[model samples]
Target: MVDTVSEGGAPRRGRFIVLEGLDASGKSTQVDRLAAWLETRGSHVHVTAEPTSGPIGSLIRQSFAGRVPLDDRVIAALFVADRIDHLTNARDGVLGFLERGIDVVSDRYVLSSLAYQSGDVGMEWVLHANEVATRLLRPDLTIYLDLPPAAALRRLETRRGIPDRFEELERLTRAYADYELAIEMLHEKDSIVRIAATGTPDEVAERVRAAVAGEL
Candidate 1:
């Protein structure tokens, strides 16, 4: 399982960096920029996101699109399943990349599950369900782009022609509150770095880079 070996014969592992925020918080853009910056420095960077393109992820997308009507518990379960697959898939998984000393920059991870799912199901249940994934794939650094729900909704309306089920202002507001509660409950105050996502992409990317400077 240990694939990375230092020049002095000591074991070393790559960093797992996760970016989390509400929809339209510019996470996707920042993740791309961060990965590109790391690759330019000769690092082996593997970039990915949640609701992966796997079978389970397809179902989650269907649920989001209203093509598949599912209970809250069922939807939450699907998220957990997709996460496990995302980490363990043989061909292209986070674990494989990390094992080979390739750093990972994920747009969204288990925290997204906690924030979004808690809006539908209670926070306690969502927390319990995500316990295993938390222990297994805990990010070395979590950058949370803290954007107000109203601003995020405006950004979504201006940018995306269509919004997903959870993109509405009301639902997003609730999810945002859930994110706050979950962050506290998970005791991520130290590991999770919050950045103001109100500025331009360039400005925000600079903050993101500064936040992860020590880890890199």
Candidate 2:
């Protein structure tokens, strides 16, 4: 197990690292790579993602699947609620693992919310909606795997038949732009890192590893 207690025996909280990017920017692949690398260095790791399997998260998924209809404002609110549960729930929550010294790597977080919902509901509202979650549990590091929307769409085309609503070039492009605003809004307590998510996966992984070295 990764060491949780200091020399004085006080428990040290584990790092919360979140990866953010467009749909096909390889965030999931990088999340797995990062967790494995951390494990080799003796840190226990938990891999998780937003739109969790919880009740609230399930609703969010249904909305995404078009099985449930939701307005932009409602979707934004749901995200915040799901995130609150992810942080403070009594079981299997991010904070629970952090308290036990297991590093938590999430596929996405508040950044995703801002980048996605802001285009429709307005940036100010999205930011305010997430303010509580941001304060509830700030990520130690948020790695943005930066990639052009066109490039990301090309990558998505290789693997999927139908395009997800989120994968549209216009939506992806707006999300890419919104991320800049989101990052700017979060600099105070959020350690945001941008990695050029180009070239091969191995090359991108190297950049991610280098960016995470300070946290090790």
Q: In angstroms, give how far residue 62 of model 2 lies from its true place.
A: 1.9
Reference-based TM-score, model 1: 0.92
Candidate 1 lDDT over 33-90, as tens digits, reads: 9999887766778999999988999998988888889898899999988998898899
Q: Which predicted model would earn the best lDDT?
A: 2
Q: What is the TM-score of each candidate against the true structure?
A: 0.92, 0.94
Model 2: per-residue Cα lDDT over 116-204, one tens digit each: 98998998988788888877889999999999999988888788454555867899999999998888988776899999999888999
Give the whole-model CA lDDT for all candidates, comma-separated.
0.86, 0.89
Model 1 misplaced stretches (Cα beyond 4 Å): 1-11, 188-190
